[model samples]
Target: THIFGKFKFQSKQGSIEDYELGDLIGKGAYGEVFQAVHKETGKNYAIKVYDRYQMTQANKLKSINNEIKIIRRLDHPNLVKLFSVHETVTNIYLVMELVTGVPLSDYIKQK
Candidate 1:
């Protein structure tokens, strides 16, 4: 089955042309988050790239919509802002505010 089989939205719905992606910052169960810069504005951001294969394996297809919904509603100093979403046949990209700091979960796990 195509990984996008269960997705309510279509793939390749948007473009990644505006931002130049940089180094990877973190890896999650279905994706890797990277540092990115907007080409025209030069603003920095964190972009999460979710692999279609990984999402299918992890059963996170619906989580994509859920994530976008949650991120769009968040308004807090500590939470990064969601800027946009870009996609391809095999990957989903989440453009977000660049937030620099040790993740609380990681910090706590070290204790």
Candidate 2:
């Protein structure tokens, strides 16, 4: 499934049973970011799904993995928290804290 010039594909290995995926909130080179709700806790999170094919093509798999490792060790109030990680044969899901604030560029422009 392709949406707005972005490729949308389902994961074959990961189970999304715990998450109720909502609208496509954002898009990037690797994949799309979806607003997801945890079924058990009713907590909202931003699930960034990275397509395996795209990551491989960009040679970003190792970089992404390294990023995850670094994020897992972070506990700062300013940083978006990394809650969990889910991997599929076709995609990787990064469950992250949903932060609300003005974009840096927008803030700069206003100033």
Q: What are the lDDT scores of the predictions, listed in order?
A: 0.78, 0.76
Tens-place lDDT digits, model 1, residues 1-111: 433343323435234767899999998777899999988889898998989778878888788878888988999987889877766777878888988888778899999
Instruction: Give candidate 1's TM-score.
Output: 0.78
- Top lDDT: which candidate number? 1
Q: lDDT tens string, model 2, 21-103? A: 99887888889988899888898988999898998899988888788889989899989898767766678788888765675
Give each model a TM-score: 0.78, 0.78
Residues forming the 10-long window of minimal summed lDDT in candidate 2: 1-10
lDDT of 1: 0.78
Q: Which stretches of candidate 1 lie over 4 Å from their true place?
A: 1-14, 109-111
Alpha-carbon RMSD to native, per candidate: 4.2, 7.4
